[model samples]
Target: MLLTVKIGKKTEKLKLNRKEKILKILKKLGLNRENVVCKLNGKIVTEEEYVGTKDKLEIIIIVSGD
Candidate 1:
């Protein structure tokens, strides 16, 4: 299964197993799940959300300002 992940100006295509969680996919990409906001198919989704083969994921990094 291939999932499209778009982060800022960069986009990546990842090969994932069936029913893989968003968190696991982030881990595979070496990204911290806690610092990123995930949106699946234009809707915000939780880390526990399972991604399908044709799903499109938009990842936005959450930044904290002091």
Candidate 2:
């Protein structure tokens, strides 16, 4: 299974043998789950969400300023 992930101006195709949690994917990409919001197919999803092949995932980084 291949998942399409978009992060900012970069995109990547991740191969997975089976359905996995979004948190795992974030970790694989060296992103902290706490700092990113995972959106699956235009809907907001949590780290526990399971994603499979052909799913479009957007990882939006949350920005904070003083």
Candidate 3:
């Protein structure tokens, strides 16, 4: 399946296993799981939701600025 991912300031299309979790995508991007939030469509999702095949996902890294 194909998923649209939003990372940093860009949106890109990625082909993922239908049941792949957000962590898999994050791992691909070299992002630490604790440092990012994963959203599907518009709602915040738990790891389980990402584990479900229904995740049409987008990810945004929450950064702290000084």
Report, for every candidate in turn, its global Cα lDDT versus the true structure: 0.87, 0.90, 0.73
Q: What clash pairs does model 2 have?
A: none
Residue 32 in model 3: lDDT: 86
lDDT of 2 by residue, 1-66 (tens): 678899977999999999989999999999998899999989998989999886888999988877
Highest lDDT: give the candidate number: 2
**What digit string (tens of lDDT, one per residue) describes model 3 on residues 1-66?**
667777868887777666676777787878887888887877888645564444457677888898
> For model 1, how does the per-residue alpha-carbon lDDT over 1-66 read when each residue is reduced to its tens digit?
677889866999988768788888889888898899999999998989988878888989888888
Q: Number of the top candidate by TM-score?
A: 2
TM-score, candidate number 2: 0.90
Q: Estimate each model's TM-score.
A: 0.86, 0.90, 0.74
Model 2 gets an lDDT of 0.90
